[model samples]
Target: MLSPASIVPVILAGGSGTRLWPVSRDSLPKQFQSLHGTNTLYQDTLKRVSDRSLFSAPIVLTHEDFRFFARRQAQDIGIDTTVVLEPTRRDSGPALLAAAMVAQRLAGEGCLVLALAADHVVLDEALFVDACRAAGRAASDGHIVTFGITPTEPSTAYGYIRPGSAAGTSEARKVDAFVEKPDTVTAARYLAEGYLWNSGNFLFPASLLIEEAERFEPAIVAAVREAVELSVEDLGFIRLDAKAFADSPAKSIDYAVMEKTTRAAVVEGKFRWSDIGSWDALRALEPGDAAGNVTHGPVTLLDSTNNYIHTDGPLVATVGVDNLAVVATEDAVLVMPASRSQDVKALVAKLKSDRHNAASEHLKAHRPWGTYQTICRGERFHVKKIVVEPGGRLSLQKHYHRAEHWIVVKGTAEVTLDGRVFEVRENESTYLPLGGVHRLANPGKIPLELIEVQTGSYLGEDDIVRLEDVYNRS
Candidate 1:
C-alpha cells in the first residue's frame, strides 16, 4: 500500500460552463473566474491540495486553449504544477486515463491518484483534506474509491450513489449502484433513504485504474496510452497527440469503469459542497440579507426579496421584484427568474443558433501576453483598451487591411514599427502604417495601458499576419 504522502492530485479543469453565461463562456469558463471568494475556483482547488505532507505536486488536465490560463492562475497563487493539454474534448473517461498515465510516468505505478474537479467549492477545507487522506488509504488497498457528499437537501442537480455494505473495517462502503440525476420526488426519496451526493472525485492507484479501464474499454486505454507516449512538450506543457487522443470515445469515468468494476468504494464527506452549476446554487451558498437577497458588485435593491443581483458594468437597481436573478456585465446582461436559472443553458444554445457573438466571446479577450477589451466598434473602425503586464510582449506582425494608432496612458511602451524599436513614454502616441510590421511590449516595471484605434475595411482578429511570435502561435 502507498503512504499518505504518495498521493498525486489530478485536477480536471476543462469544463465550458454555459449556465453561468455572460460571465462564463467558452473563452473563459467558470473555473478560471472569481465566483465565490477572492480567488478563482481553480485557485481554490489548487490550495486544497497544496499540503506538501499529504499530497505531491498536482497535474492539471485541461484543453489546449486553457493552458495559459491554467499556468498563469497557478503562478498567481505561487503553486507549481504540471499541465497536460488535451487536444480535444473527450469527456472524463479519456481525461482520467491520461491523468493515470501521466501520474505513473512521474511517480511510478505505486502512487495514488486523487482526481478532482476544478470547479467545485468546499466550505470545510479541513474536512476535505481528512476525507482525501481516508480515501487515499482506501484507494491504496486495491480499490477505486469516490467521495460522496452528505446530502443536505433534495438536489436534482447532482447524481446519487447507493452504498451497499461496509468495506472491511474502515468507514468506506462498497457501492451498490450509481444513479443519474432524478426528479424532485426521486431525489427526496434518495435523500431520505441515506444516499450520498456524488461529488465526482475519485482516488485509486495508477496501475489499478489502468487495469480496470482496459477491462471495460480497451479502445480508450489503447488510444490514451499511445497519446501519452507520443505527447510533445510545448511551452512547459504536455500536449497530447491530437489524432491518438481523438480516437478515443467521449465518456465519463463512471460509465467506462466505475459502474462495471467490482471494487468500487465510497467515502462519506460531511463538508458543505456545491458545484455552483447555476445562479440559484450560488445564491444558496452565499449569506443572504434580511430580505433573502444575495448581491455582488454595484447592486441596489428596494422591496426585492429572494433575488440575486450582480453587476460589473452599470449600477443594477431593482424594486418590487421577487425570486429573480439579474446579472449584468460590460457587454451582456442575463435576467431570469431564480427558479428558472437552469434554463440559462437553453438560452445560450438559442443564442448560438442565432449566431450571436455574445454566445461565446466576451468583451475582454485574454492572451498569453495580456488582455484587451473592446471599447467601441462601428463601421470601418474599432477601438480597444489594452493592458500589458510588465515584461509582456506582443507578436511581431503586420495587419493586412488596417492601420493602427496607439496612445500610451500608463507606464512605457516599447514599440517596434517596421524594424525600428523605440520606447514611448506615458501620454506619448505612435502610429503604424498599413502593411508595416509592428509589435508592443511593456519594458517598464509597472503595467502598461494603452488605447488602440484601428481604421480599415476589416477589423476582425484574423486579419493579422504573424512574422514572429514568442508564444509559438501560428
Candidate 2:
C-alpha cells in the first residue's frame, strides 16, 4: 500500500553518456557503472527515494536495451519500482509526459511527481530530499518546479536559470528565464548575477504537467497518450507503443515545457550535485592525492600532477604527465589532456562514423540472464565466455549461420536440445549443430559459466530465430 501523501518519483534513465568514453557506452552507460562508489549512480538515485513515507515506488523510464539493467539495479537495492520501457529514444519531453500520465493513473491528478535523472550524483542526500520537499510544496500548488543548484563555479557546461519573485511564503521563486550553455565570460556574469545552474530535475503535479505539455506541444501529448494507452506488458515491463512513441518530437523538457510554461518555478538546491558529464567532471568530484592525481584500478603515477588515470585491465603507469586523462579497458584505451575531456564525444562520433564497435559497445555485453564477453574473434569463428545467473534462462532459439560448442567451466547448466532437456555438469561439454534449436539455463544455486565457441559463416547477433523466449527478446 502506498501513502496518499507520498510523491511519485519518475527517474529518467535513457541517455547513452558518450562523453565518458572508454568506460561509458550505449551498451552500459555511466549510470549503470560504479564510477564513484560500490553503488551505481542509478542505485544511488534509487536509495535517495527509498523513504516510503515521503516517496512512493518510483516510475523509471528507460529504453529497451537497458530495461533489465534498470530492473536488476532496483532489485539489488530491494526497491519496488515500476519500470517503463521506452520503445525509442524520444528525449525527456515525451518521456516525462508518459510518466506523468502513468502517475496520474496511479496516484491521481493531485499527486506530485519528482522527475530526476538516474545519472546524477548528489553528495548531500538530506539536503536534496529537503529541497525536493520544498519543491513539492510549490508543485502541489500547480506550479512546475525545477530544482536549481547553487552555482559554486562559473561552469559553462550547464544551463542557467534566473530566479524571479517569490512564489509564496515558501523559498520557491518564479523562473524569470532559462538560458542556454554560455561562454566562460557569460557564465561568470551569470554566476555573479545569482543565477542557478539548471539541475535538470523537476517536481510537478501530474495534472499540471499534462496541462502544460498539452498546451505547448499538443502533438507530443497526443502521441505519448496513445503510446501509454496502447502500452503492453512484456516480462513485467510496461513497453510503450513503438509507433506512437516514435511519432513524438525528440526534444528535451527544458525546450518543450520548462522554457515555455508560465507556471515554472525554481527551488534553490544547496546540495552538492554533479551530472558527471565528462571525465573531467568526474575527476573534479573525486578526491585526489598530494600530487593532485586521481588514480584507480592498479594505476601508478610518477611526476604526474592534476591527472586522472583509470584502467579496468592492465596496470596504467604514467610518468611526467601533467593535466592528462588516461583510461583503459579491455578493448579500448583513451589518452588525452584533462582539459580536452569534452572532446571525447567528437572522438566517439568519429568512431561511430568509422563503424568501430568500441564507440557504442563494450567487450562485455549484459543480457537479461547474465553477461557474455567476447574473448577473441576470427573470420570464421569466435570465442565467448558466458555467465548465467542462478535460475536464469536464455531463449529457445536457433541460428541460421552458426553452430556452437559449449564447454561448461563452472556450476551446472541445464541444456535443452530440440525439447530434450539434460543437465551438463562442470567440465562437461555439449555441441549444438547449425539449425538446431537449443536453450541454456542455470538450474543450480550458483552461477553457470561456460566457454562458447562459435564456427559459422556469419557471427552476427541478428541471425537468431527465437522459437520461444521467457524474456520476449523477439
Candidate 3:
C-alpha cells in the first residue's frame, strides 16, 4: 500500500470533444488547448489540486492515443502524475471503478477518490476547494458525494440534483433525486424549486464506492478489478488489460451507482463553473465589448452586436454581424448563428459522413516526440514543418513509396540514415531515398525545427514501415 494521503484526484482527460470543432478535434481536444486563459483546462485542473496538504499525487485516466499528451502536459506544468491508460471507451462507470480499484490497491481501503473532469473550468477555485472539503467530510461518513452547482440560470444543458435534508453537521445534504436535462419550462421550474446543476464531479472512499458499485453493477466491478489486476506498466503509464476492460459494460456512473444508491449526498457549490460544451457557452464566459462582440486574434468588428469571432488563420473583419460565431483555424472555418451553436455537432456529423479530414484532425498533429504541421500537399508532393522538442526522437522507420529531404532550420539534428548516424546542424540538409531507413532526433537543449519535402507516387501515412520504435508501436 502507498503512504497516507487524504484524497487521490482521479482526473479523466480522454474526451474527444466535437462540439468545439475547428479548434478542438480528435487529435487535440479542448482540455489540452489554451481556451479559457494562458493555461489549458487540464493544467488548471492540475493546479487546483496541487496543494499537498489537502490532496495526494493525482492519477490521470486517459485513452491510449492521448497517453503522451496527458503525461507531457502535466510535466510542462511541473506536476508529477500517475498516467493510466484505458484500453477502450467504456464510459465513466468502468473508468471510475478502475480508478477506485487502483487507489484502493495503492493507498489502502480508506483512501478517498475525487473524480474531476479535466476539461471543465472552475473560476472560483477557493470556493471549489472549500466545497471539496465539505464533500470529503460527507464521503468519509460512507456517502457518495457529488458537488452540485447552485443554478445561476435556467439552463437546459445540465442535469439537475434535488437535495433533501442535511447530512449531519456538514454542508452536504442527502440527494433526494437526480433529474435528467429538462426542457426549458421544466428547467425554469427546477430553478424555482431550488435544484442544483450536476457538475459530474464526485468524492468517495475507494472501498465504499467499490462496494456500492458491486452492489449495483457486479460485472463492472469484476471486469474493472481484473483489468486493474492484469494491468502492466508501460513507460511509467498503467495500461489496462484490453480484453478484460472490454468485457465490462458501457454505462455511466449515474446509471451504475449514484442514481440507485441511498447514501448519495450533494454539497452546494457557489463557485462559477462551465463545461464549455458549445461555442455559445464559451462566448457567454467571456466579456464582450461595447458592440457586444468578443473577438480574438486580429479581428475587427464593424457594427457587430453580440457576435463571437475568433480566428488564428487570418484577419477576420465582420460587417454588420449580430448573434453570430465565426471561428477560423489553419484548415477550416466555422460560421453560424451564436444561438445555433448546439447545431454544430450535427454539422460535424455531416462532415464526418462526407469523409472530411477536418472533422477529426487538425493541420498540426502531435506525436510522442513532438509535432508536425502540413504546409501544403498536392497529388505527388507534400511539404511539412516539424518541431521536435529537446531530446525528442522519432521512430526508426522507412517509407516504401516516398523519398524525403529535410532542411534543418533550428537546433542540431541527430539523423540516422541507412544505419549511418550523423549530426546535421542549423541550415544543413539531408536526403533519404525511397526504402531507406531513417530517423530524426533532437540532441540539443533547444527545440529542433525543420522543413521536410516529400516526393512519391503515393503519399500517405500508411506507407510508414517501422523497423524499431521506442514508443513500442506496431
Candidate 4:
C-alpha cells in the first residue's frame, strides 16, 4: 500500500465582494461573512478539506489588513494557518504565485498544492475532497490540474471551460479552450453542450508552477524567488520582500502560466459549487420560503415574492417587492431589482466618491488581538464596545491624545498600564491617562468583553504608538 500523498492547501482570501454590500465592506469581505451557516465561507472551506496527515498547514494569501481576520478564522476552526500577507493590492496571479512559493518551501518536492478561493461553497464536501485527491495525483505526475465544476444551470456569470479530450480517465478532461465570461446565449449553448463552469480551483506540483513562472514570466520568477529566498519569519506570518514582490508584473495564472503551458489539465468536480459572485447568484442559492423570499437577520417583507432581504443589524421591512434584493445596515440601505444585483458595485463606487464611510469601512473593526465597535461619539468623547478573544491581547502602546476608561462586562482581562501588569475581572473598571502606555487582554478561556469610554482632544486610531504586541504590530 502507498502512503498518502502530501497535499498543501493554499487559500486565496483577498476579494472585495462588492455585490453583497451593506453587510460586506472593504474591512469585512464576504469570505468572512456567515451567509449560509454558522461558519464563514473561508472557515467552511477549511473544514471541507481538513485532513492533518494528508494536508499540511494551510497557506493563506490575503491582504495585509485582513491578516488578523484570517488568523482568527483559522483559530476558530482549529486549522493551523501559515498566512502570507500581500503588501500591495494585486490580482490572484501574483497572490497565487506568492502562496505557491511559500507552499513549495513547506512541502518541498513531489508534493501538490490545492489552491482555492475562500468564499466558494461546495454542496458536496466528500466529492470535493475526492476531486482534490485525484487532482493531487495528477499534479504529482507533473500536470497543472484545475477543477471544472459541473454546471447545474446556464451561468453567464462564470467563465466556461471547454473540455478537449479525456485524459486517461473518465473523470479527468483536457482543456480544449478557456472562455471568458460569456453572453447569455453563449452560456445557454455551453450549458446545453455539457460545458463545465471554470471553478478557479487548481492543483499543481510546486516545481511545475515555479518552472512555468520562470519560463513565461521570468521577471516574476526572479522577484518571487528572491522574495522567498529572503523571506523573514515574523511570528506566524511569512513576510515576503515588499519591494521585490511589488516589482513583479501582475497577472493571473491563466494569463501568466496556465494558458501558456502544455501541462494543464482539468478534473470534473462531482460536487455542486457556486462562486457566489453577485447578490443575484447568492439569492439563487439561498433557501426561499413558500412565498419565495430568502430573508436573513431582521427583515419583514409584505407581498415580496422571489426576493432576498439581507441585513446586518438594522431592521428591514419590504412591501410588494417582487424579484428584488433589499439589504440594510446601520448606515446604509440598498434596494435593487434582483436582475440588476450586479449594479451594487456601481452604487458602492458612488458611495466611495461621495465620501461615505459605509462603502470602505465597517462600524466594527477587527484587530489582531480583538474587535472594537463604535458605539457613540461626541465632540471630545467616544464610546466603544471592545471584545478581546481568549488568549488575545492588545498592543502595549500609548495614545498621544486620548485617555481610555475600560469597564469590563464579562470574562477576565489582563491589563498592562505603563508597564505594570494586573488583572481586571468582571464589573471592574480601569483608567489609562493620556500618554500612558497600556494594553488589554483576555488571559482566560472565555471572551473578554468591555465597554470603553474615551475622552481626548483627538480621538482617532492613529493616536496609538505601539511599543510591543503579540501579533507583531508596529
Candidate 5:
C-alpha cells in the first residue's frame, strides 16, 4: 500500500538534450516536444505515475528560462504541479534540493519524494508504477530506494547496477555497486554477470534526504536550506536563492549523495524504458516500415534503408541513404549518420563559438500565454505569428524602441493598448506606438492567433520593460 498521508512526486524536468538536436533546443528541449505522439515526453511521465488519491501534487524542478513552458506542460497534462525554478543549471543535486525543499514546505517533513526524470519513456506504465510503489514502500522505512532497469542487452551508453543479496526475497536488494558506463567488453561482462541499468530515479523520505545532505555536503545543505526556508512562494512555485543555489556544487545525485550513502537500496524494474538520450535511442522508439525507414511528416524514400527521416514542413524525399538521420525544418535541415549522432554536441559547440542563435532556439518557442513562431525578418523589421491560449494574459509591458502592430487573424483578443484595455475580435487590428505599455490576452473560447510586426532601430528581446505580470516575473 502507498503511504498516502504524505507522498509527493518530485520530477526533474530540466535537460539540454544536445544529442536530439534540431527538434530539441536549449530552452525548449525534447521533454517538452511531441516526439512521436500527441503528448510530450514530460506529459507522458506525469500521466504514468499520477494518481490523485495516492500521490500529492507534483513538485517540478526546472531551469529559470523554461519555467513558463514547464508550467504550461504540467497544466496541459492535468497535473497540479508546483514548480521550483533553478536560477541556473547547477546539476541534479541543487535541482533535487530545490524540489525537496518545496516538497517539505508544501507537504511536510514526513513526506516521501519520488524523484523522476521527465525525459524518460517507459512503454509499460503499469509495471513502472508498480516498481515505484515498491520503492515508495522502501522509502517509508527511511531508506533511499533507487530503481534499476533490468538490462536486456550489453549497452555501453548506460551505467550498470550490480544487485547484491536479496532483501528478504522482495525485488529489492542491497546495491552491491554502481558502475559507470563501460566499454564493450566490460559491458558484455556486466551483462553476463547479471548487472542492471542505473536508472536516474530515486525515492527518499524528505527529512532523511535533508539529513543526509546535512552530513555529507554541509555547504549545499546550508545553502539549500536557507534558500528554501527564505524562499518566495508565488503561483505555487518556490524560487531558490539565485546566488546560493548557483554556488552549490555542480554534481549529479549519483556522485553527490547516493553513491556514499549506506541506506541506498535498489528495486529491480520490469518496464521497457529509454532515456531518449540520443537520436539513435529516440529512433528506436518509433517503428519503421518494411525497409526500416521511419518518417514523421510527409516524406518518401526510394533507396533509403534503416533511415530516420523527420520533416516539420514540406515533403522530405530521400534516395540511396542507409543508417542515416535526416530532419528537415523550415529554417534548418540536419543530416547525420546514426553512428555520428553523438557528435552533434560538438557541432552545437561550434555553432555557439561562431555566435549562431540556431544552436539554442527553435522556430517556435512556447510561453505562459501560448506559442510564437518566427515568420520572417528584415534589416529593420521582424514578423512573428503569436497564439494566445484562451483566458491567458501576457505581462503588462512596454518596448523601449520597437513599435508593434497586432493583426488578429482568429478568435478574440483582449488588448491592453497604452494602459487602456479593450477587446478586438476576429479580423480586427490594433497598434502600439513606440514607448507605450501594451499587453495581449485571449478572451474567447478558442485560441487567439495574431500576426505581430515589430519595427525599430533595435529589436532585441532585452528592449522590453515589464510593468506588471500575473505569472509573477519581476
Candidate 6:
C-alpha cells in the first residue's frame, strides 16, 4: 500500500455546464450549486479525499471567474485548499500538467496524485475510497491508473475502457483500449463484452505523469512548465501566466496522455457514479413518490408521474403531466420531456444566438464580496438587491452615465462618496450623482443587505472606472 501522506488530491473544477442550463450557467455552474443535497458536488468531491490520514490538502484548478467561489465554498466546509487560477480554458490536459508540476514541487517526485472532476457524484463513498487505495497501489508501481466504473447500463453518455490482464499482484489491470461514446447498439454490445465506463478519475505518480507527458506531448509540457514557473500568487490564488497558458493546445487528458501512455492501467470501481450531466440524471438520484414524481422547492404535483419539477422561487404546480421535467427559476422556466434532457445545450445555443442574457448568467450575479440579484429593469432604470458579507467591500470607483440610489435594509453600510465617508444605518438611504466616486462596504458583524436603483442613459457594467479595489477587478 502507498503511504497515506504521499497522496495529493488534484481537483479539476473548470467546466461550463451548458447541457444543464437554466440552472447551470456560465456565471455559476452545476458543480458549485447545491444540486444533490446540502453540500454541492464540488464540496462532496472534496470531502471524499479529505481524510488527512489518506490524503493531503487538495489543489483546486479552476477558471479566473470561479476562483473566489471555489475558495469560498472550500472555506465553508473547513477545507484548506490551494486554488490555482487558469488564465484561459485550455481543457484538462494543460490543467492536469500544471497541477502535476505543482504537486511534484510540493511533495517530491515519488508522491502520488489523485485527479478527480469536481462535478461527479459518487454515491458509495467507502467503495470509492477503496478503489482509490487500490489505484494507489498500481500507481506506486509506476503505472498511471484510472478508475473504471462497472457498467450498470448501456450508457452512451460516457466513454468506455477495456481492461486487460492483471497488472502484477494489484487488482488493477492493463488498459487494452479506450473507446468513445457509442450508439445504443454498440453500447449494448460493449456492455455485454465486459467493458467498463471511464470514470475520468485517475491516480498517477507525479514524476511518471510528467515524464510520459513530456514524451507524448512535449509542447504542452513546455508551455505548462513556463506557465507554472511564471505563475504569481494573487489574493489567495495562484494565477498562471496568461500568454504561456493560452499558447498551450486545448485538449483533454484522455487525448493527450492517457490514450497514448504505455503505462496506462485500469482499476474496477464498484461505486455508484454519476456525472449529473442533465436533469434526468439528477432526477434519478432524488427521492420520488410512489407515482414516480420528484419535486423540489415550493412545487405541487397533481396527477403527475415520472416527472421532475423544481423551482427556486414562487410556486410551481403541475397538473396531469407525465415524463416531463419542469425547472423554474426567478427569471426563466424550462419545460421539456425527460428523455430530451441532452437537448438543453441546443436550446442554450439558440438563446445565445439571440443574445439573451439568461442563457449565460442568472438573475443573481455572484461577486467576491457576496451576491447581487436583479429585481427589475426598464429603459432608464434598473433595480437590484445587493448583499454584502461582513468585512466585504466594493471597489472605489465611479460611473460615467449612471446615478445610483441605495437603501439599507439589513445591517450597517459604510459608504464612501468622493472624499467623504459616512455610515448609513438600517432603513436609511444614500444617493450618488453621476460621475461621483463611491464605494460600498460592510463594517458590521452581520451581513449587509440593500436595494440599489440606477437611473441613467447607459447602465452597463462596463461604465465603471475603478480607481482602487480590494478584490482586484478589471
Top TM-score model: 6
Worst lDDT run of 10 residues, candidate 3, spans: 1-10
Alpha-carbon runs more than 4 Å astray in model 6: none
For model 6, how does the per-residue alpha-carbon lDDT over 291-348 read when each residue is reduced to its tens digit? 9989999988888898898888879998898999999998889999999998999999
Residue-level lDDT tens digits of model 5 in 351-416: 889988788888787777888999998889989999999889999998878999999999989988
Tell how far residue 402 is off in model 3, in angstroms: 1.4
lDDT tens readout by residue for model 4, 1-474: 114537888999888888788788899999998887899999998887687767777888888888878888889888878888787765777777777778867777656788999999888887888898777766766678889988887877899888888665435667878889889899999988888899998988877888887889998888777777777877677778888888888888888887888778899897988888888787777778999898889888787798888888888887877888888887788888888887888989999999887898888898877789999989999999999988988888999898989999999889998779999989999999999988888889988999999998999888889898777777
Off by over 4 Å in 3: 1-4
Worst 10 residues of 5 by lDDT: 1-10
Off by over 4 Å in 4: 1-3, 52-54, 168-170, 411-431, 443-445
* Residue lDDT tens for model 3, 1-474: 123358999999999888999899988999999989999999999999998888898999999989998998899999999999999999999999999988887777889999999999999989998888888888888789999999989998999999999987777999999999999999999999999999999999889889999999999999999999999998899999999999999999999999999989999999999998999888888899987899889898777798999898688888888889999998899999888888888888999999998999899999998999999999999999999999898999999899999999999999999899999999999999999999999989999999999999988889999988889875
Query: Which 10 consecutive residues of model 6 have the lowest summed lDDT?
Result: 1-10
Please, what is the TM-score per model? Answer: 0.98, 0.98, 0.97, 0.92, 0.93, 0.98
TM-score of candidate 3 versus the correct structure, residues matched by position: 0.97
Candidate 2 per-residue lDDT over residues 200-260, each given as its tens digit: 9999988888899889999999999999999998888899999999999988898899999
Return the TM-score for candidate 1, rounded to 2 decimals. 0.98
Cα RMSD (Å) per model?
1.2, 1.6, 1.8, 2.5, 2.2, 1.0
Instruction: Score each candidate by Cα lDDT.
Output: 0.93, 0.92, 0.92, 0.84, 0.83, 0.93
Question: What is the per-residue lDDT of model 1 for residues 258-349, given as tens digits with 9 covering 90 to 100?
Answer: 99999999999989999989888888888899999999999888889989998876899998999889999988999998899999999999
Global CA lDDT of candidate 4, please? 0.84
Q: Which pairs of residues clash in candidate 5, taking residues 3 or more apart in a chain or in different chains?
A: none
